[model samples]
Target: MFSVWKISLLFMASLALTAATIPGKKDRRPLGGWTDVNVTENDSGLQKALEVAIREHNKASNDQFINVVTNVIRARRQIVAGMKYSLNVQIAKTDCRKSDSTPENCTESELSRLSQHKRCRFVVYLVPWLKKEELKQNNCD
Candidate 1:
């Protein structure tokens, strides 16, 4: 009787240990995707806008990330095409950072803000393009 009880207890302990070592299914996906924009320099204003939009989105019941894409489409009687824009967004629970060092690398205060507010961390991307002449024109501005 004593040997049987000891064997049962050992089996239960091993099973518990194995279960504790395995990761939960929900904890697996990557945090964010690459941005579509070719950013040569850091733009503070754009970053701020993204942060604000993300904060609002995550505060809602559904947690999702937003993706904005743009395309040029021809308009009637126009030599150039009009820009077409679309936003694709969805929410899923995800791990923001797997390691402790992420907070150190974040420039935007949004990460810290999310931590304090107990909100989901949202990922966003903005894409924009300009013709050569348009780029030259904007270069002077």
Candidate 2:
């Protein structure tokens, strides 16, 4: 009986050790991991990220008119030194330019042979406390 009890205790100890080493559902959010954020969640933060992307896009674009996000397709986030936002969005060309009176209510270009709403993916890194955002990458089609 003493030997049997000793064996059961050893087995339990091994099981406990294995549990810690094995990855589980709870381990999904490990350090430096990216998390899929709902497009509707964190409205202000998402908006800021979108703005950064749009500003950068306009800066690099040769298109005559400015582009604006028409829809948010998806969003992801990673916690780095500050935070990183990954966005997949649909953008439409607008009639407003840099000197336009107001961008609001600007007509959007139609999705036709010559022009179409673009699907864009942008990755932005931001340090919130500093209120600064850098566009790490942008791709659109």
Which numbered prediction scores highest in TM-score against the true structure?
Answer: 2
> What digit string (tens of lDDT, one per residue) describes model 1 on residues 25-125?
86643334223332334644334333433344434324342211111111111122322211122222233432332322333333332232222223333
Candidate 1 whole-model C-alpha lDDT, 0 to 1: 0.33
Name the lDDT value of residue 9 in candidate 2.
97
Q: For every candidate structure, what is the RMSD over all alpha carbons to the true structure, in angstroms?
A: 21.7, 5.8
By summed lDDT, the worst window of 10 consecutive residues in model 1 runs over: 132-141
The residue-by-residue lDDT of candidate 2 on 1-141, one tens digit each, is 569889999999999999888888876687888888878766777788888898888888887677788889999889999889999999887657656623344445432334568899999999989988899999998
lDDT of 2: 0.81
Best by lDDT: 2
Candidate 2 has which clashing residue pairs, if any?
none
What is the Cα-based lDDT of residue 8 in candidate 2? 95
Poorest lDDT segment (10 consecutive residues) of candidate 2: 104-113
